[model samples]
Target: MIKSTDIIRCCASPHGIFWLTVAVLAIPNVALCFTERMGIMASVTNIVLPVAAVWLLMALGRRPGKTALLLFPLMFLAAFQIVLLYLFGHSIIAVDMFLNLVTTNVGEAMELLDNLLPAIVIVVVIYVPVIVLAVVSLRRGDVLSRSFLLRQRRRSLAALVAGAACMAGSYLAGRDYSARLHLYPLNVFYNIYLAADRYKATADYPQTSAGFSFNAVPTHAASGREVYVLVIGETARACSFGLYGYGRNTTPMLQRTGGLTVFSDAITQSNTTHKSVPMLLSAASAEDYGRIYREKGIITAFREAGFHTTFISNQRPNHSFIDIFGKEADDWKFIKEETERSDMYDEDMLRMVNDILDKKRAKELIVLHTYGSHFNYRERYRRSEAVFRPDNASEAKVSNRRQLLNAYDNSIRSTDRFLSLLIRQLDRSGAVSAMLYTSDHGENIFDDGRRLFLHASPIPSYYELHVPLLIWMSPSYRQMYAAEAAAVGSNSRKSVATSASVFHTMLSLAGISTPLRADSLSVASSSYKPGERHYLNDHNLPVAIKKILRGDEDFVMFRKMNLKY
Candidate 1:
């Protein structure tokens, strides 16, 4: 029973056109939920945010030109979602994804675009018409009359109230659900802000001598020629390793290698390399990550303990957190110039290792950061080295699931070769030496039907955090420190462990006594206890590691020892 005059006025006005554009763009937003196959309640709840956004835009876009421009942000966000959905088969804009697009170099960005060309085409097809429609609507001379403005001002206030009420209701229902609401531009904005703030915090963080002292060193400093090698791997998951009970023999070399102890329960503190590497290299934990980097990192401690510290990386040297620690080392070498390189394999770092070891420093600690099993898994190894054949040939599409798994397993096998060669080098050195190996973070390969394909989701998954930790020492080193070897062997099967323990354990491995060191956190000590491990996302949201691993939301346990976070 609508009047013809009223319908004509609505069609001719800029306010009406802007709302129409918003409504069209909103389909992609709500479509995200349906595509993910979320429950009816969750899908219905998600509409509340977009509806509020529509009204808020209507309030702000009173002017014709302003309305068109404002609509661009939402439309662009929707376009971005379309591209991601086509590429990853999902639309969860995460902190790592934001930084990779905005902060990474042009080449890396190009590589990413090149990999997802098919998805890009789909995005263009879906969004180009909408963009045209918006521009045409904006170019119109239509305006809001005095009467219309008065009415909209009132609607604007109501929309604001409704938005707030919707957010509150979502939060009251569940904190986790509230965080998961993927409202297009708002969610995108939150992730970008978090990435920028996090990077700034790391760069501008202050370091003081307040809690740092050199006099805390204990009397167990190495007497003879000793070498401590730490190999920091990239994107390796414990479940993929044969030693950790995987069906595939991904880590055949490690399984057959002697004098290697595998800690089955190890997990990383963060899922991204930027955050995880800092936590592993520095005495940082989930509770005090902001201020922990202010203290001197492990490299500084080793240098102070009269050991020649060296850092060699196969990955590019663009990471601020890693670069800061590397700068502190006596010798820092970067073998790879590009951030993402397909021609250079992880074995490239071995040349640097051999060169450094040739120097024969009496007491030294060398850290090798390798490009191990990063995405585009097929490119990580050479064409000749692709042992697992018929893997995914196109990055844009997973035409075959078994092929993708084969490619991933092949990359893992390449890592096994790299580690085995590294151990052989240490063995040949014949110096009292020990090597510690672990990945910065793990990768996600759509294990569940949920279609989660990568790390950095706000949601926590067990495979993304559970990483492999291996400790290998030469015969001479084991004989020299039998007690330490025994302790490591005894604690390999402990139910809980985290990268936070790396700082304390590295200090113990170097036999350097320091007040900052805690024996309870060290795996090579009788008093060692695998205490409660807490996992955190880029937004600083906490998830109980134990609860998630057990697939139980409500499980409680007590800690036998107190360890500072």
Candidate 2:
């Protein structure tokens, strides 16, 4: 048996330290093999390429330890990747994830971090020691002998050749195994580049869209009093809503209300609010996101049609496209900005709506951006709305799923009451009114074995894509626009609908005609027709929904709902 001192000496040797560094760097690649389900050849190339890269660095550097410090960035990325994998299960780093890093508020970040402690612990345990070892090696000034360096360099070259051969074989087999797409560090870096490009485009949005116009005209005469409200909800998944056939009575208030048409097959084109909310507000769909850069949102369309438009939001602005679009309204305010707190309920937005209704403009379009059922759900509603018990769990672990869901469902109940009250307020105002409600996107709550929670995963689940879309026409409005009301009711369950329909449908409901409006996409029009559903991929490209459903669970879900993916 070897002595402890001998083992320690061996570990401290230049060759041993180099191997340690390689192993530490390979941890993420090994994790990727499981998370991404890489093929044998692809996995081999993934493992070998990094080994060769680190070996080459070791061979080229005059002092190995000093050179290893360059790898700190890679180590940090690895830590981040590991945490994301733990949260979302699979997929590479996405541009939206990077945007969220900057867009998410301090309170929201702290709430998320509270649930992410387990992953954080693992990352610290794995990476902290490596950092300490790197410093120690640098202080020791360890150097490999010239002969040893030459031998290692040759081995590294051979390793690179083997990795290249594996890549070649994978390509010949018709696998899309490109280094820029499949490899870890390269793919993550490419996502960073994409994020940077999107940031630049966002900065240039005002100038790019300055000259765009809807040239909208109202078909209905401006004599009558008309009120239209679009309530944009946050993180409210369809599967949890009682109106959508959930076992819980999460939406009793809305269920009891009359003239509500529920679209059973509604889905959002994108999961992230920053992307999805803009799509809902603008005429852009995933198929034509480029239009978003060139055109203003529906608020502008309504304004041009000679309506007094107002936007009231429960969320704080992060200087995103959402803010730009909201400001296009004649008047807009972020409720969170006024309160300086994140715990305010969705009902806070209704006060602004009530104020606007009291103003009694002849023709008005009010958009209420609600903080409906967002995470840390207990804080979203009052204690009386906590009909679902034991909803106090703050941690996001799967074991506490029942409590988390209780809180989430309770928040939904609160949203139901808020909507019911708004509808009542609108009805009492005696305007020829219609209200359209849809979530920015849905959420995940450990619904299945995948253990996903929250929205905006690089890869979406069935829960994240499916959302509730409802239309409620007041009695007087239904009487005035009988055919449009009937058309909306008839088309409620006719086909798969997307949040893209919101702009055209709202315009149709208000009898606003614009060259930009597509009647085929408007559910309130007799010309409406169903079309294939698509999702916005991480790259912001339109992908056929069927192509992105990762497993049979998502496929079965769509099929059960009779939705064409």
Give all candidates' CA lDDT scores: 0.71, 0.86
Worst 10 residues of 2 by lDDT: 8-17
| Candidate 2 segments whose C-alpha is farther than 4 A from its true place | 1-17
lDDT, candidate 2, 1-565, per-residue tens: 9998887576556676677677777888888888886788888878888778877876776556766677788888888888888888888778899988877778778888888888999989877866666677789888778888888889999998987888787677667677888887788899899888888888899899988889999999667799999999999988899998899999999999998999998889999988999999999999898888889999999999999999998888876888989999999998878865646888877778888989989999999998898888898999877899999996868999999999999999998999999999999999999999999899988888889878888888888988989999999999989999999988998665466799999999999999999999999998999888788888889988888788788888778767667
In angstroms, the error of model 2 at 204 is 0.7
Q: Using Cα atoms with residue i matched to residue i, what is each candidate's TM-score against the true structure?
A: 0.84, 0.95
How close is each model in CA RMSD to the real structure? 5.5, 2.0
lDDT for residue 214 in candidate 1, whole number 0-100? 46
lDDT of 1 by residue, 39-128 (tens): 444455566556665655665645654565566766676777776665445556777666655445565556667777776777676556
Q: Candidate 2, 382: how far from true, in Å?
A: 1.9
